[model samples]
Target chain A: MRAPLAERVGNYLLLIVFGLFALGPIVTILVAALGPDDGGSGSSGFGNFGKAWEIGHFGSYLRTSVAVSVSVVVVSVLLSVLSGYAFGTMRFRGAGVLFYLFLVGIMMPTEAIIVPLYFDLRTLGLTDTFWAIALPQVAQSVAFGTFWMRAYFRSSSRSLVEAARLDGAGPWRTLWQVLVPPARPALVTLIVLVFMWTWNEFLIPLVMVTSESLRTAPLGLAFFSGQYTSGFTLLAAGAVIVGTPVVLVYAFLQRHFIAGMLEGAVRE
Target chain B: MSSPPGEPRKVGYLYILPALLVYGAFLLYPLVRAVHLSLFEWNGITLGKFVGLSNYADVVADAGLRAAFGHALVLIVFYSVLPVVIGLALASVLQRAKVRGLGFFRTVVFLPQVIAMVVVAVSWRHIYAPDGPLNDVLRAVGLDSVARGWLGDYTFALPAVGVIGTWFETGLVTVLLLAGMARIPRERYEAARLDGAGAFAEFFAVVLPAVRGEIAVAVTLTVIAALRTFDLVYVTTSGGPGTSTSVPSYEVYHRAFELGQVGSAAAIGVCLTVLIFVITLGVNRLADRSTA
Candidate 1:
């Protein structure tokens, strides 16, 4: 059906306005990052990126961020896949209660638990260790990840599971040979989403790891801005450095990224 | 030909054990301890006398805490309501028109969601600076009197920061709405059009009702994001300018680590958790009932 001419014009105009509103901050930041900087003058050129790199120690921060995010993603995904299979396909006593407990983990916010988490970590003498950040995040990730993978498994065709079982395949063998391959899309989606979330997470690292050397990229950026409060250009440059990779990922994997988010949102 | 169901069931229990143990150690233990701590007074290194109900009392009585919650509500307006409205409107438009460069437009809009919040916060802090682009535009338009320190001034700081939250979030909401729109069967709209419905009428009659679940999901997520408004505030304001932009999460941070009021901080955390849980449950129930 053809839209009326007036409606078409109005829709295009609305889209343009919304597009600009969405893009305005990013464009403004890019321009500001490029502008010349004095104590109060406007920022200019690529100089700020260099200055930000040097001043923020962005190189070291980026390395730490990459290491932490990758580790979290790998560990979280592996554990989630194992547990998701169990929860989804297999029947067990107490499974319903155990799953409900995991659901409770979903509602518990970081703020609600972080104070005690801090004390817990402190007691274990792992306050500033990478594990302090990674372990809790992995736990949090498992709650959602297992849920995600379970949904994927439940929705998966039962014929394959039955066929594998008929071929004398055990639960573990079927999961490895039959289920895992078909579940790859969901698993990939989970990995990317988890990586993006863990990489961008701030509060966990801020509270759990006080050592400057152990700071993730987001924490480092916060500290960098605080330490160099007056340097807008440097801040903008640092922002770009930290923000670009995820933006690039979203650009490329727009479909998967979006599907992952929607699945998480609508599933539970 | 079925195997005994009980054998596989036993294996399933064993399979879930590792995840359950990890969850028990990290999430459940900490949450229980947090609730327990909220009932007493203790600094990290020292155990003080029991202060039952006083921590809760302090959270309620504190002027700053009240202001912070108010600020969080303001953020909901900016972050949750505004984004949903704008995103829904845009989704409506995109659904109606065959726009050029649709994919590019979608990608650009959704870019902010993938970017770190700290980066977005820092970038916007510059934009809100006294001599930044915002003030520059204000001056250029002969509205010099209106321009002030956006992040530094107490009056504008909270709202200014809240607007950044809006900017960061609108894209994700748009994508979610768009996905919902995509799922709406085209035949329903065709049927509506055949019945002589206008664009607005068809939207209300068909598209809106179908996407109710997505809208609920969007609102729930956005509200939680608004309530947990910390990263941007931390990076940009640090609850400064007389704590104008402090939210509960930020206050919890300050109390727990900065002031060493671990027990009180735990109380605040508990309050925040309960508040969020109740609100989300209410929202979900309302959404379920309305849609049902």
Candidate 2:
């Protein structure tokens, strides 16, 4: 049954008002990015974007973002898939205890460990390098990714695994051939999520590295806003430049990403 | 979950070794080292004498640390409590409204969840600027006396920062609650109306209890956001206006990086993690009780 017209109107009004509150700042940035600012972008043009692009050296930062995210995803996902398969399909000694240990990863906030991790990386001489950021993030992502894929694999039909094994497929072959093809949704969702988190990571970069050239996009964006304080158009342009990559990814994979997030939250 | 004909193979440890090694080296080892460092008086570089819990003493005694923890809890009021309340209200309204363009509204609302925190902070910094739209709107409505540098005002800065957290969290909580509410049968709402239940009664008696697990999920997520917030606070105020907004995460960064006081930072970090663990455990236990 449908709601009464009065109630329907009230709900839309409420949603639209809150939607404005949610999206108002982004719209503010959008307008400022496109509009004019004194002594920047001349007048009524998008040269602010060009100027922000150059001033922030966003090109280099974007490259760093891509490199770090790609490495983290590849390394984390490979490790997670292997571990997830084992946890899903096989029973080892201390299996329950070990899985609980991995779940600890979810509870430990990045802030709690990053302070000491900075020193550890410096001792290992990995500070100011990509590995410093990527490695810890890879661990974090794999913790979640392993939990995610393990659920997927556990719920898969055992008959499929048995059939593949009966046809002489080893465990590795069964995983590659029988399980993974059907798990593409979970895999893609994990990739998109890990990519977003790693690309958008700021604190690890802020603490771990001081080199300007090696800064990730979000870190570069913060510094750019700090330096270009008087240039609102440029600041707005810088924001869009930094945030647009993840927004694009979200727009493209909205459904899978939302499903994954909700599932993760519900599980927690 | 299935009972196998033979005993379960223990060789699966070999398959998980690579992951466990990475987890141990990067996560577990760092955690252990953080605890170890917390007991000493060393800076980041040098080997130093053990202080034996004095750094933790500093964390307990310091006024600055207390304020940081207080600010984070205040943020929980905004980031978790207010959002959850608002989410429940929204879900109650939307669950029966049969609205068109539901997906579009959901996207617009959830858009903030995906944006970079640095970007969110920067965008909000503009909104709270002295000459920003907020002030302009205040002036237009003839309430110009109240407008100030929100992120700079001592009384308003922490709440100003909390508002941003609230803004980001509301959509997420609302969507989560709505997802849970979707499972409630429509006829239940009709039955409530047949018994002369008004909106408030219908909601509290039916919608709210049905979504207990979701309320727990929302609380857990948002409380964690409040407790562990770093990037947003970093870019916005830098824990400024005389440390009115210094969260534990910010303090950890400031101590370890700026002051190079490694031990106390580790101590505070450990304390913060324990607090989060306790709160989350309590939340889950309470949630499980309600659901069961």
Candidate 3:
């Protein structure tokens, strides 16, 4: 019933090699951040963090990232749940066509839309502003969120929504009171996903915001590396600073993240 | 779960309006508008000229742009093809092995997926630097002649960058294939064994045919990453040395933002979008036919 011993050993060997490939860069960076001063390549203790923080201007980038990601999550979650509720629970004349239209939104990469969007935002005088960065991400997240939640609502317990309706509750009340509370896991997964995507997003902020102060974490890190090309220790510390929040969140909620990704792939 | 409301009414429409508006204005409109822009010549600050089909021609005719597309295709070799093959190999063994610490292995391997590409690019840039660990290993192992500044060298730059894509993607492909492999019936493997199949024979006859959907998904995602990669190139090489690693997305960025070639960028964007659409659709269709 089991694989042969040699085969088992071979699998372990493959896993070990893969583990090193994946974790090696991360460990190297962490060591260069916290390990002993190998001359300028690394500095002992946490001084690199402080120095990278100041040199990279991470304080402003962090704020911009927080502001943009939170707004994206909140707006995306609200709009998606509402829309998903309709798409799932109600029938309409153009539902199928509209659903595919959103699917177009899902399939359309940022590369495809970003050019016209830049000019469009420029005409609206919003380029170089945070709204330029935040709005498009909200749109991207909502596209996925709507599809994801609609699927959830369709499969979830119908009795709850029916009971609320029978009790003369309005649609809004039914959605918020009867459904939203129980939909915490789906919403959390969506929020975490939107956060990571928005946080890691590079091109939009790169294209939209020319203002140094408005840079998000990843964009700021790119600029930081460009400026401190030779300062391996500082750059490594900066890389950690930019990547750590998402990694920590993934560490904590990896189960949910993995589940969402798998299920979402089916949606795709 | 519920039947259509007795009549579709204001509420259904109202609930969807906000999401549709954002998606419409930002995603849908821009896509359509981008296609529109591809047909004309207009700088962001200028009165436009109408130039139909020229930019698309340039996408093909311009040596640099064509090279960029070529680089993306080359990346597909490293990013998509190799990873899927490697993933299948890993999945085959792990499926048979009943490996311990599989969760830990899975998490660590998928680490690249979780990290930002910019961070991945920066870290690898250092690793590929002259005195970095990779070259150190090369020298220590008595292969010093093969090691150099990977991201800077013309000959090795594209492959070096592709290797990063490989590293990032191999984990994802492995995990996805493993997910598909788990659903395979035990009897199938037993059947292969009964047929006097070797490992290669079993893999080709049974395992390969079984995980078509996973392969489809993995290829689509990795191919898209290869074609559309931006952050990695931007941070690591900036399409470097002399355009050795420029992919279309980077060309789109460079033209629009840096060179002020708005129409050309839009044209390339439309072309890249079509390429992605056609290829991914073809992949999915092929996958479905085989599996079904």
| Residue pairs in collision within model 1 | A34-A44, A34-A45, A35-A43, A35-A44, A36-A42, A36-A43, A36-A44
lDDT of 2 by residue, B105-145 (tens): 77778888889999999999999999988898998999999
Per-candidate TM-scores read 0.94, 0.97, 0.96
What is candidate 1's lDDT per residue for B183-276, written digit by digit as tens?
8887998899899999789889998898888888888888888989888888888897988888999988998898988888899889888887
Q: Please give fnat for model 1.
A: 0.74
Candidate 1 deviant stretches above 4 angstroms: A4-7, A35-48, B1-8, B194-196
Query: What tens digits encode model 1's per-residue C-alpha lDDT throughout A1-268?
Result: 6878897788777777878977888887787677776535443588778877887898988888898889889887887888888878877766777777888777778998899998888987999998898888888988888888887887787888899889999888998899999787898789889989898999999998877789888889888888776756767888888888787777777778888876687744
RMSD in Å for model 3: 2.0
Which consecutive 10 residues in model 3 chain B have the weakest lDDT in total? B1-10
Per-model C-alpha lDDT, please? 0.83, 0.86, 0.87
The true-versus-predicted C-alpha distance at residue B261 of model 2, in Å, is: 1.7
Candidate closest to the true structure, highest TM-score: 2
Residues B1-292, model 3: lDDT tens digits: 2353333556788999999999888888999999888888887788878898899999889999989999999999999999998999888888777789988887888878889999998889889999998999999999989989998999999999999999989998998898889999999999999999988999898888999888998998889889888899998899988888899999899988888889999998888888888877888899888877
Q: What lDDT does model 3 reach? A: 0.87
Tens-digit per-residue lDDT, A1-268, candidate 3: 6777776677778889888988898898888777554436444569888878887899899899989988998999899999999988878888878887877666667888899999989999999998999999999988999899988888778888888989999888988999889999998898888888999999999999999889999999998888775557888888899999999999999877777776676654
For model 3, what is the error of residue B88's alpha carbon versus the real structure, in angstroms, after optimal superposition? 0.3
